[model samples]
Target: MTRTQAPRSSPSRTSPSHLLPTEEPLALLRPDGTPVEGSPLVMPADDVLVELYRRMVVGRRFDTQATALTRQGRLAVYPSSRGQEACEIAPVLALRPDDWLFPTYRDSVALVSRGIDPAQTLTLLQGGWHLGYDPYEHRVGPQCTPLATNTLHAVGFAHAARLKGEDTAALVLLGDGATSEGDTHEALNFAGVWQAPVVFLVQNNGYAISVPLDKQTAAPTLAHKGIGYGVPSVLVDGNDAAAVYAVVRDALRTGGPTLIEALTYRIEAHTNADDATRYRTSDEVAAWLARDPVDRLSAYLTARGLLDERTKDDVAREAETFAAAVRAALNVDVEPDPADLFEHVYATMPAHLRAQAEFLREESA
Candidate 1:
């Protein structure tokens, strides 16, 4: 049977009635690590949950390390996805090998979870040239800095793939703030009209920089925005890795446009340069800290006897090793040749650029 049709074990645990999504966000696990009522249609195995937990640990480490690197004058800047690791890693795990992921600037964790080397994934953030790694090699689009621009690119790619009759889908991720951009609306509209095999996952981290959701839009919910475009929508607890994975996997099986709005929080500032404390309160941060995605999964696994002290130690050791490797890779300074900047702009260098390149060459000589 296809993965979407795979049978799942029956719900073995009962949870509070309020835990499940009605018109609310779907939450599969409570904050205390208990399973919610109405279990997912296609539950993943214990091993899969273990792996997801491992990735979440690594993703958290990556964010912390990157933020430290920025503070230490190593990286140019960083947009840390500290509190949203579940949203960062789960959807990538749900996709097929041939599927494409279009990530936002803050989605370094997602790209890393998708098999890109941590160093390569952060290259753009390091102020390096040319998106760090080849997009075609990894089937990941550029780590886009411009808001909502990559949404259109993802839709176009999916439409082209459908035209070519390829069994492929594209997943586009954007911040809640980007939902307000015109490009986002246009992309969703096109995807719905064409029935493109693309999914849009909005990580609603409660703010657009310092602007809270209340200030960003008057829409009842971001998912509602998709309904107007003729696309189905889901509201998932962004902190529940299992639920996010299940929803994304099911959406992929539909072979059409869908939108998933994950209600999450951005634990860190918008980036290393921004001071979140100036706008948000410490109590607010403390409240979300209680609902941390990594801690939630670890608690659930431990309660189920799936995670023990040894396993926790192993995951922590692995995360430390990964962080060390990323630090070492990023510490090596790269001295780019100034003249090489003029080489890749076009197949044949234009006369104006040729003159500029000559000027740089003579100056350096």
Candidate 2:
């Protein structure tokens, strides 16, 4: 997640409320497109806000295109971030070029916002022979499908950067359900002990596949769990794009590990295969639609005179162009060679496997 920046609050609105999340989710704008009143929330500069909005538009378009590919059998599986666009875009925009991002399977949109090619970002889901894009090229790790495991990798990578005397930070995106995993616990512990620069952004999108947040945990909120590991935590309305961006920017500037739980909803089915309607009601989805991230930002920007009809039209046109290109790219088949299966298996290939590769090579030849 990259482009978000906004403000926060809690019991100690004036006090140094480190480690305490605001009573309510932090937000800079209301659903009706008005800025929240009487809060010290820092609004992002107009330019940054506009950029955030644009990337989100392009990101969502890319997301829909990816989901469409699944229905066309061009992809194996796709977890749609249809309603979680704020969590998908912000925070990555706050990063410096030297920073690293450890994303989850649900974060193809985030990867695109980070300037990754859309086709390369979907290569894994397309069953490509490689990771599709070079991880070094964008400093993004392979998309981790296993829940919460990526957090540990982020901690390790950030700690190593610290050891090497580099000012690098790692932002790891996890779902609400991932907080229960032991890997999240260990990652927090290690990050706290080493004071690593790692920001854990939990997109609490209401469900972990079929399980709702209530069934997932009894903790007051996911952010509170950070206190146990001595990591500072904050809660924000994930739908408020500006607020999300502000909180993430401050957390990174705070100079240590932070955990953020952004309250959002997963509008689509868990994937191209899961049936979301079975677990959630249409009314529930409708309510969230009123608070949609993209709409919230667009409305707020328009009211402030920062966004005009022309700008909106231009953004939409650009998004459509991007989507068309992605569609065209995926329309072509990318065939993988059989011998590639053994290529990255080991640095020093064993004799038996070496014979197998040779046999396959001979067969192909």
Candidate 3:
């Protein structure tokens, strides 16, 4: 009694708790707008921070504007990246000039951050032209719409770069739902075996169309899937640009294939044609809104006295000017040629395709 009977250890210490597995990659700013210790951010450096903020704002504005255009029947179906701007922007910024990017359908915001002309994106969306740029010139591959197929392309690119002794890396974007596909698994396996310099970025936006995450897999986390493939994996806050950038940079420096599972939410419908309310609840939407990336960054900047009312107004005005310019450019009515498809099939058209092209020409005439 006098020795205060040795504190009994809880037997629960040996028991594992069934909690969702997560990897909290380093975050520069805390939720309350405070800087974390040893963060890579230099907030006082106004130029870089302001430029990064501008890119994020412009990307978001462009996405919102495009959604409106789709609804107004100006463009065909458009993927809305409403709550995903920061996730797209961060990795694009972290890339070197010669590095390659494999963008998915919803990664237009990524192209914007990587210096792609907004008009070109619009042209593709409006069906006025093919991608409208030489992929080699931009080092950005054509957008892949066949879900997880681009993962293999990224792996191949990395393997080629390694063979050529090139100091470059490949970054491939995919949706969380894409992980269920065989291609995604194969890509990871090959990359890991070869130690390819590539990064597999999975934007976990909680839903693949109408199917929720729980139904897709019994695995604790998408990032953990990489473990079996022998690729190092990490999870990060996709909504936070700083966090995303940090993780991408780390992956790039590590010199091997890495899988990043970015935990984010799809605030808008999957695309303009989708009706999220049919499956998800309003309460879920409201909760995500509370964690809005732009709002979070704005609050942080304001709290630090870096952003004020006048600065916000200036940002708004700049965004509006950009949107107006994009709108005017997109309004130009230019229909692409149907025959152009046959033109690019080969350097010298195959005999059968050539005959087919002539047949089409004669039929049209």
Candidate 4:
């Protein structure tokens, strides 16, 4: 999860007892679009911010397109990232080119930001011959659908990198719900013990499928759990990309494991197959909408004169073009050969598997 810096609360007008209570979370921009003191936060260069914005726009568009494509039967079910693009993009862009990313099944946005082709995402969803490239070769591990299992793999990768004297780090993205899994706890322990160079990013979207966070844990903040394991942790406003970037950057740069619990809300259903309306309220959605990440960033940029109507229009058009291209690419059906599944299972198939493969072929005929 990324660090979002909210406006600083000051001690009263000039008196010792006039101080206001500090908001638990930090945010450089408030919900109303006011620019709080932007300094002291790890301020990214303008180019980096623009690049981050581009990635967010592209990711949002890709998610929208994929959702539509699934409805049209062009692919298997898609888990929409609707309203959570910044939650995906900021930390991803904060990484060095050589850094690795371990993403969850729903984190296509992070993969896209990492330079994975849009077609590859569709291919994975479609279950085509190529669910895409070898992730290790791409420096982004395979998408982990088994909840928190990938966090262990990330720790292992970071451990290996340390052994090899590699300077690169790993960032593992998992949902807030994943924190409840035993694998997540074990991974945190290993990462702490080994002092692994990885960042456990928990995108706290307030729900674990239909289960709300309250039912998932009694901890006041997920970040606090890291303390028990001896790993430093911080909770941030997940929607503020700038804050997210700064916090994540500091964590990654300092070495060892850091847990960033990004506070956010998932506005849509867990996936195309789930109905959020069944378990949540429209009022809750409306309330989160008021703190939408994109709107907040846009408002900040506009106030600073960095984003104008023309620039906004251009960004929207560019995103639409990318979405159209993804739609067009998914239309091409690439069938996987039936024998291909067995081809890559082992370096050399044991006699039993060899015989089984033949048996399968004959049985199919």
Q: Rank the candidates by lDDT, best first.
A: 2, 1, 4, 3
For candidate 4, write residues 289-336 as lDDT tens digits.
998888887887778778889988999999999898998889887665
Worst 10 residues of 4 by lDDT: 13-22
lDDT tens digits, residue span 1-365, model 2: 34585544443433335777888888899987789986566988999999999999999989888998899998999999988998988888887788899999999999999889989999888877679889899999999989999999999999999999988889999999898899999999999888899999999998889999899899899999888787889999899888888988887776689999999988889998898888989999999999899999999899889999999999999999999999999999766778888988799999999999999999999
How are the candidates ranked when ordered by TM-score, highest leading?
2, 1, 4, 3
Q: What are the Cα lDDT values of the candidates?
A: 0.89, 0.90, 0.81, 0.82
Tens digits of lDDT, candidate 1, 1-365: 68789687774733433222348788788776788888654666788889999999988998899999999888899999999998999999999989999999999999999889988898888887777888898899998899999999999999999999999999999999999899999999999889999999999999999999989899788887876777888888999998888899888878998888999999989998899999999999999999998889999999989999998999899999999999999999888999879877899999999999999999999
How many Å off is the CA of 344 in candidate 4?
A: 1.6
Model 3 lDDT tens row, 1-365: 45878876854532222112254544676655566787543333445455567778888999988888887777887888888877888888878787899999899888877877887866567665467656887899888888999999999999999999998899999998899999999999999889899999999999998899999999878888877777878777787777777778778877789899988888889887788999999999888887777777777778878788998888888889988887887777776666886976588889999888899889879
TM-score between candidate 3 and the true structure: 0.87
What is the Cα-based lDDT of residue 95 in candidate 2? Answer: 79
TM-score of each: 0.92, 0.94, 0.87, 0.89
At residue 326, give the lDDT of candidate 3: 76
Q: Tell me, by TM-score, which candidate is best.
A: 2
Steric clashes per prediction: 0, 16, 0, 10
Model 1 lowest lDDT segment of ten: 13-22
Model 2 has an lDDT value of: 0.90
